[model samples]
Target chain A: MKMRVHSSCSAAFSARCSRQVAPRAASAQAPPAVQVDDFDFQKYVMATAEKVNVALDAAVPMAYPETVHESIRYSLLAGGKRVRPMLCLASCDMLGGEESVAMPSACAMEMIHTMSLIHDDMPCMDNDSLRRGQPTNHVKYGDDIALLAGDALLAYSFEHIARETKATPEQIVRVIAEVGRAVGSIGLVGGQVVDIKSEGKKVPLETLEWIHVHKTAVLLEASVVTGAIVAGASDDDVERVRQYGRNIGLCFQVVDDILDVTQSSETLGKTAGKDLDSEKSTYPALLGLDESRKIAQRLNEEAKALLEPFDAEKRAPLVGLADYIYSRTN
Target chain B: MKMRVHSSCSAAFSARCSRQVAPRAASAQAPPAVQVDDFDFQKYVMATAEKVNVALDAAVPMAYPETVHESIRYSLLAGGKRVRPMLCLASCDMLGGEESVAMPSACAMEMIHTMSLIHDDMPCMDNDSLRRGQPTNHVKYGDDIALLAGDALLAYSFEHIARETKATPEQIVRVIAEVGRAVGSIGLVGGQVVDIKSEGKKVPLETLEWIHVHKTAVLLEASVVTGAIVAGASDDDVERVRQYGRNIGLCFQVVDDILDVTQSSETLGKTAGKDLDSEKSTYPALLGLDESRKIAQRLNEEAKALLEPFDAEKRAPLVGLADYIYSRTN
Candidate 1:
């Protein structure tokens, strides 16, 4: 497959090129010669995000006990990049799975992601008042309701997948077990605990990597792997997707850390410099900005390499997603 | 299938005799009448509680990120009646399943119960400082860690069941789905929202029952049903156990409401008069104390009646558990 560059990048990504060693040159060196320009990465992301939004809107409703439902809906329905769900859907699509079959798991991934955000923004946690350009759940509802809403979302995530997925019971069970592990103590919560304890301390790079791997990478890995499992991918294929997910997952956080210092609060839609303000060790803090950017670029390339063996056309969206995750820094 | 009653009631239960509308007379009317002094209900409860404690102690380890594990262990290991787990174990035992096969789900029940308690004790929720005669999780660990710990437990509940359950994958999936429903918006979380919303207001008896059914009964229902499911119970058998669980589950809450009015905080191990202080509707608040006690007794009998079809000796623990739940108010 011949590779060509997409000419149009979003304005948000424009700033990324100036700050780092050239990413395009690095990505150009390794490829199965694919025509990238034929695949509109931005259009794919926006389309997938739109579908995910519609599915998510239907996933949670404002029912009885309106406050709790409202609290869950408020954060969930609020707009985001929809990266997790998009990744999930794209992975499923690449494996010849119907979007309808994968929709519930896709929505479940988003719900899980939203839950972490809701709890992470609690007063006792990050004490943040804003998220995604609006008041956080705790700010809109009280802390008790916010916490409950997060919990409801977490529980609902598993229920939604089990109830809605058209996959076989075996696939559904595997998905549930995998997703459960991704969010359990040894996963998201485990990482958050370590991150919390390490705050304001001079932390080792190994510890920082541990935190991100558990907190961030595991869930992303779950998202991609669940989609593939639902689509009935073989073990080898699933493992390959998992590696791609892990690489891009870590890259997602590394870029996020880079944006914390580089972007304005308006552009990021969250408090800029909060990481530095809290003295939390980040990729940029631990490694210099140039080193961090280079690492993120390398991770993005490695994630792409994992997908090279697949049909280039089928893997286009995923390949593009890795670039988008890195390109967000612009 | 002979049915018998235990003659000696604990001192706490002696007072229940006069207020209840002749529970003995109601029970005596049922068939398979045998000696009342044969089974020791209290002994069975204590033995089952001890086994549950040992299983729970091994369920969560003080691994790395000891803080979250500690927070989970702190509340989980803290003493409670272990009523849910006992019911689960008893249900599985009645179905001729090994206790080892049911232990994971039993531990999951306790974990889920502890999660609801921890979140309920948050400052913004019930705002209670004491639980199980010790400081609540939020009081011991900061609210942040407590919230995370609760989330961790909820996720781990599913993981523990999925990973540790010896049942078929289909059964494990069904259990996970059932539990997710139990704790989701339509179950524990939903009931809590209504309870919080109804605070300080005059709620109807219907609404009070709704709150108790969803908030309390569902988890207990899940506990028993999951155990039966894990044991590969027949559909008819599962349905019977579910009914038994529902009756006792509702009975569990009604007795709790009665005790809140009749017992001391020291006796309850958590603050008493909380329902009155918060002015939230309870069974006793909607119905008179005598009526509530009568309802609790009636529920206990109805629960026992459902077990009449099963082998009496096999169901002894469950039958005795219904008595223990009601006897707690004594």
Candidate 2:
């Protein structure tokens, strides 16, 4: 792919977004035959994740409700991989939108993602005590503060978008509606209910897909779709972006299931094969590891194919992200 | 108070808003000495409550994952007085806006109110067994579903407003910001943390007010503020409306405190004296009952006085609603 990526993470991003000089330098080691610009996918991901983290830290400050804010800050800053936010920023970047315009929404994606994790780890839900290499929100802050922290984060996500996003009111409202549905009963919550209901029971592939599609894929779709919308992409383009997002989202879940069975707890940072212990149906469990890997490969290939119609250089981050999701061990 | 009220709730409201002819008739049997219009406070509340209930029922349908939706419907449709919604409607009505313009926000207020109750009643929080004359959401639905149900309702409230409200997108975004802040850590959840911390201790009067103001009054303020904003009211007028809302909100809490001490569980529909049993500070506990009642009266008067500058006929419902709050026994 034709690309503008370079060694410096912030420099490559700022070259596209900022009026200042593009301090970005193309790789000096490029072969004379091809003169290819090697896109530093890891650096791009790191750069975007840093921006999301900074915005999030400033977004929710410790105030009078110290415990809840402390609780919110704890899980929020708990050092997740920030994959959802990276996807959001990458989509916006691909569509030639400024990082400043999409940063609030990019941070909001992480906030919702964090809230799902916090609530999912509660005693009433999965009851997992560890997440992202640290004690869970409920495990560290106690259930009451943990619940309120999740709720505060959820409520604040819309508020942060509405209050901070430098978009037209129409676009902001659209983003809110898009985001609300992604987390509402029909989206993450719906998938959760089904997953909870189906635990320890015989499950079909379709049902398992439904669980992951809603629980995992829907928010990822929303993250990308919203970024595309904020970038003023046309409806047709947004739909294509949605399909791309959906493929990667499902691919991410398939990879997760594979990792659960194949990777040890030392690498995954949580109990390996816990889903098997709980009898939760997963891609690898339902369709052997090899088949699940094949499905993931198909998903990633389809995801990148959808991006071909866009500018190849500008779409490098998303293409790289899909590859990262497919190849990562954890 | 010179007023435009009549026997029928729909008639009285329609007279002010719809182009349809006002079938509203002034009281034929007005006292000859004063020639006063008797605003039927009961019918206005009942009528507005009916409208809010219909909107709420239409807002959340039982789609997939029936359990969460059922839990949401249970607490949402459970017969509270619909006080928050009525206050929202009353604010819009007083500002001369159509009920249709504000009805979605009106229902949204109740959605938020219901969410707070659901979260507050979980065993990790207040652990209440009964609410609005029925079992609490967590008591009826399992804790997991109950938590998700509350999360769903809270998420849907914003979606409903953004999707359904007919106002300008700016107005809707502003309303979302307002409502979101009202429920965030520094709003309802903030007050809740303080309340929880203060339990089984001698909380000061100031601390008690702080708790109720955040936990209770913040949402009330948002409810009225959102309604007025959707009605196209100016900032100064909205602030005036805000003052009126704050007074009524504080008054409602004080009366709740008094009833907790004076009323029985059977009469008040829930465990009335449970606040005392938990050693939670209340208006009557911090101040003598006589003083607390006097404060409610003062608050009610101040609340009504703020509405005096508006068209007397237009403000009748709000005036009557404040009076109803003051004189209410349960």
Query: Candidate 1: what is its chain A TM-score?
Result: 0.93
Return the top candidate by TM-score. Answer: 1
TM-scores of chain A across the candidates, in order, are 0.93, 0.89
Taking all chains together, the TM-score of candidate 2 against the true structure is 0.90
For residues A222-316, could you state the per-residue lDDT of candidate 1 as single tens digits? 98999899999999999999999999899888988998998899887788899999999899999989999888888887888788777778888
Please give the distance, in angstroms, between residue B285's alpha carbon in candidate 1 and its true position after superposition: 2.2
The DockQ of predicted model 1 stands at 0.74
Residue A186, candidate 2: Cα error in Å is 0.4
lDDT of model 2 at position B29: 37
Please, what are the lDDT tens digits per residue for candidate 1 over residues B134-230? Answer: 8999888999899999999998888788778888878887888888999999899999999988999999888999899999999989988988998
* TM-score for candidate 2 (chain B): 0.88
Across residues B1-330, which tens digit of lDDT does each residue of candidate 2 receive?
Answer: 323333323432232221211222334533121111466555767877888898899999888889889999999999888888888888888787888989888898899899989998899888889886789999998999999998888888888888999999999999999999998998988988888888888888889888988888888888889889999999999999898888888887897888788778876778778898888888888888989988887787677667766876677777666655555667
